[model samples]
Structures are given as structure tokens and as C-alpha cells.
Target: MTKSARADMITVLAMQWNHRKVENLHKTLSMRFVKTTQKAQTEVDNLESLKQELNISLEDTEQWVLEVKQWAATDSNQTRHRKRRRLTELKKKLRERILQYNTIDTCTETIDTEAACSLSEDVILPWEAQGDMVNLRTKRRLFDQVMLVRRMEEEKVIIVKEMTQHCQNLRQALEKLDHLLHQTKDDIRNQSMFHKY
Candidate 1:
């Protein structure tokens, strides 16, 4: 073959080899770009999922706080009503005791000195026996009720404090999340505006 023809053939072969290398490089770069893009997209999706999870958790916590408040309020009202009723019953008992005392006083005034002297210290009056029994029972009942109410109030106070603290923490977390969301929205808006300009 002529030298000119041989040189031209070599140049053509080199050009073909360079073109193959460029094509391979382009394909590799394109694949890498696609893989990177998909990885970034997955990361974004994960972040979105995490945000949703956080939101759901906050909502559930807030709901629990609300339910606890409702329960506390209901229990408190019921306790108040029971206390009122107990007070009213005690008042009634007091009135009955006063009437019994007055009746006994009248009876004693009419009692002869001989009969009064015959009744020894061991010979208890019927009214005294009945009043003592009733008073003892009422006293025991009142003591038990008072203790129960005190315990319940203590529990209520503890629950209220815990709930208040939990609610406050939840509120702060929600506020922070809201603020972050707003900042993200503003950044996105600014980026869009920047792109437009």
C-alpha cells in the first residue's frame, strides 16, 4: 500500500478507538449520574417518611394528653359530687343527733330521783347505747372515706403534674417541628424564586 493510504488508515483506526472510549465514558458517567440521583431520591423519601412518622407520633401524644385530661376532669367532678353527698349525709346525722339529745334531756328532767339513783353506772341508757353504736359506725365510715379521698387527691395531683409536663414537652416538640417545616417551606420558596429570576 502507498504511505499516504497507510497513514490515513491508521488515523481512521485511532479516531474509532477514541470515539469508543468517549462513548464508554459517557455511558459510565450517565449510569453514575442515574445511580446518584436515585440514591438522593431515596434519601429524600426516607426523610419524608421520618417526618410523617414524627407528625403521627406527635398527634398520638396530643390525643393521649387530651384523653388524660378528660379522664381527670371526669374523675374530679365525680369525686366532688360524692364529697358533697357525704357532707349532706353528715349534716343530716348531726340534726338527728341534736334531736335525740333534746329528747333525752326532756326525759331526764321528768325522771324521778329514785329511778335515776337506781340506774347504776353500768346500766346504760337505751338512747346512749344506740347513739354510741351509730356514732362509732359513722365515725369509722367517715375516717375511711376521708382517707380514700386523700389518697385519690394525691393521685390526681401526681397525674396532673405528670400530664402537664408531658403535654408541655409535646407542645414544644410540635412547635419546633412546625418552625422547621416553615423554614423548609421558605427555603423552597426562595429557591424557586431564585430559579425563576
Candidate 2:
């Protein structure tokens, strides 16, 4: 081969080799990114489900407290024995509900860890990569997907924090209700004793 032709062939081969290397690297990175995003998505989905359950639990607890308060207030007019029996039932329900809240609290504790998931930044954008080994449009789409997942993760954290606070508040409220129930029971017992005397 002529000297110039041989040099040109070598240069072309080198370019091809570099391009192939970039292509392989890009493919590997993309696969990794896909896996990461899917994992993040799954985590988000799980958190969303947990949040729904938490919301339901919160509402139920609040309503339950209100119902208990209203019932105790009205029960003073009822016979003492009937009031005592009703209060006993309410206390039993509260114990079961506290158990449910404990389960939800456990889920929330683990969820914070799940939200710790992060995306790998060791990727080359198609436009920034050597030899255009990847499609810019494809890379952009992947980047968009990553951004979307990141936003969802951020929102999930905010929601979880808010709900955590709500859960704490609800727990305090439940404690108050429990104390009020005890007070109500004491009042009922005293009324019975007063009537007997």
C-alpha cells in the first residue's frame, strides 16, 4: 500500500475502535441507569402505597377519637352499668388500634431508608461522548426519565416527613383520648358509688 493510504487506513481503524469502545461503554451505562431508575420507581410505588395506608389510618384515628369523646359525653346520661360496658369496649378497640399504629410506624421507619436511593452520575451524555456513539435523543430521554424519578423521590420524602409529623400528632391525640377514657371510667365508678351510698 502507498504510505499515505496506509496512514489513512490506520487513522480510520483507530476512530472505529474508539467509537466501538464508546458504544459499549454507553450501552453498559444505559443498562445501569435503567436498573437504577426501575429500582427507584419500585421504591416510590411502595412508599405511595404506604402513604395511602397512613392517610387512612390517620383519618380513622382522628374520627375514632372524636367518636369516643362524643360517646363518653353522651354516655353520662345512660345507666352506669351500660356506660361501664361501653367504655370497656372502647378501651379494647383502642388497644387494637394502637397495635395497628405500631405496624405503620415500623413501615415508616424503614421507608426513610428506602428513600435513600440515589442515581449513579457516572454516565456520559450522548452529545458529550466521543464519536457520537449514542443517540442524543435517546440519551436525553433517559436523562428526562432520571430527572422524573429524582423529582418523585424528592416529593416522596416531603410527603413522608409530613405524614410522620401527622402520625406523631395523632399518637399524642390518641394518648390524650386514652387518658380521657380513664377519667370517664373513674367518673362512672364514682357515680355508682355515690348512688349506692
Candidate 3:
């Protein structure tokens, strides 16, 4: 074979290798994007469900408080004492739940942001500098994928923030309920003393 023909053969082989590498990298990146998106979606769903559950629990606690108030209207010192103890236990449980909710929200946000930023930053493939139309097309496609992943990350962040806000609101409500319970207990004690005098 002539020298020129041998050089051509070598060039062709190198191009084939580069094409295979680019293809493999693209597939790997696509799989990673899909997995990350699915995981984020699951986290958002779980947070929403947890928020709903917390709202229901808050309503139930409020109803319990109203019942205690009605029972207090009657002159039963023992019942008042028992209700006060139960309210304290409920307040403690609410505090624990609030802490867990805040911790989970922070963790989910950190993991999601880190994953998204890392993936987006590295999406500029080495093959992008090959200066061929084929590589150009591949680069464009990869860029679009990166944008989509970034958007998903932003959505996840928003959802986590909303969940955090809801948790804070619930915590405040519990604190208020605890304060009211303390007031009621004080009133009961005063009335009992008056009766004994």
C-alpha cells in the first residue's frame, strides 16, 4: 500500500475510537440524568405527603384542646390534671416531629443541589472540541440535557422550601397550643384553691 493510503487508514481508525467513546459517554450521562430526576421526584412526593399528614395532626390537636376546655368548664379537678398531662405529651411529640421534618428538608436540599450543580458543570464533553459537524450536534444535544437537569433541580429546591415553611407553621401552632394549655392549667389551680378556702 502507498504511504498516503496507510495514513488514511490510521486516521479512520482513530475517528472510530473517538466516536465510540463519545457514544458511551452520552449513554452514561443520560442514565445518570434519568436516575437523578426520578429520585428528586420521589422526594418531592414524600414531602408533600408528610405536609398533609402534619396538617391533619394539627387539626386533631386543636380539637383535643377544645374538648379539654369543655371538660374544664365542669368542676372536675382530676380531669383537668389528666388533660394537662396529655397536652404536654402531645406538645413533646410535635416538637420531635418538627425537628425531624427540618433535618430531612435540609438534607434533601443539599444532596439535590450538589448533584445538579456537579452534573451541569461537567456536561461539557471532551469530544466537543473535535471540530466536526457530528461532534457539534452531539454537544448541542448534551447541552439541552444539562439544561433540563438544571430545571429539575430548581423545581426540587422550590418544593423543599415550601415544605420547610409548612413545617415552621406547624411548629408555631404547637407552641401556641402549649401556651394555652399552660394558662388553662393555671386557671384550674386557682379555682381549686378558691373552692377549698
For every model shown, what is its TM-score relative to the native structure?
0.27, 0.29, 0.32
Root-mean-square deviation of each candidate, in angstroms?
A: 31.1, 40.4, 40.0
* TM-score of model 3 (CA atoms): 0.32
What is the per-residue lDDT of model 3 for residues 17-128, given as tens digits with 9 covering 90 to 100? 9878654654554565566679767655554454364343445434544544454477367877987887667656655654554477444422233322243544432333
Q: Count the backbone clashes (under 3 Å) in each candidate.
A: 0, 0, 0
Sorted on TM-score, best first, the list reads: 3, 2, 1
lDDT of each: 0.57, 0.57, 0.57
Residues 1-197, model 1: lDDT tens digits = 99999999999999999878654654554555565556555654554464364344445434544554464566677798997888667656655654565567445533233333343444344456665232333233333433444455555555556556656766897999999999999999999999999
Question: Weakest 10 consecutive residues, lDDT, candidate 1?
Answer: 132-141
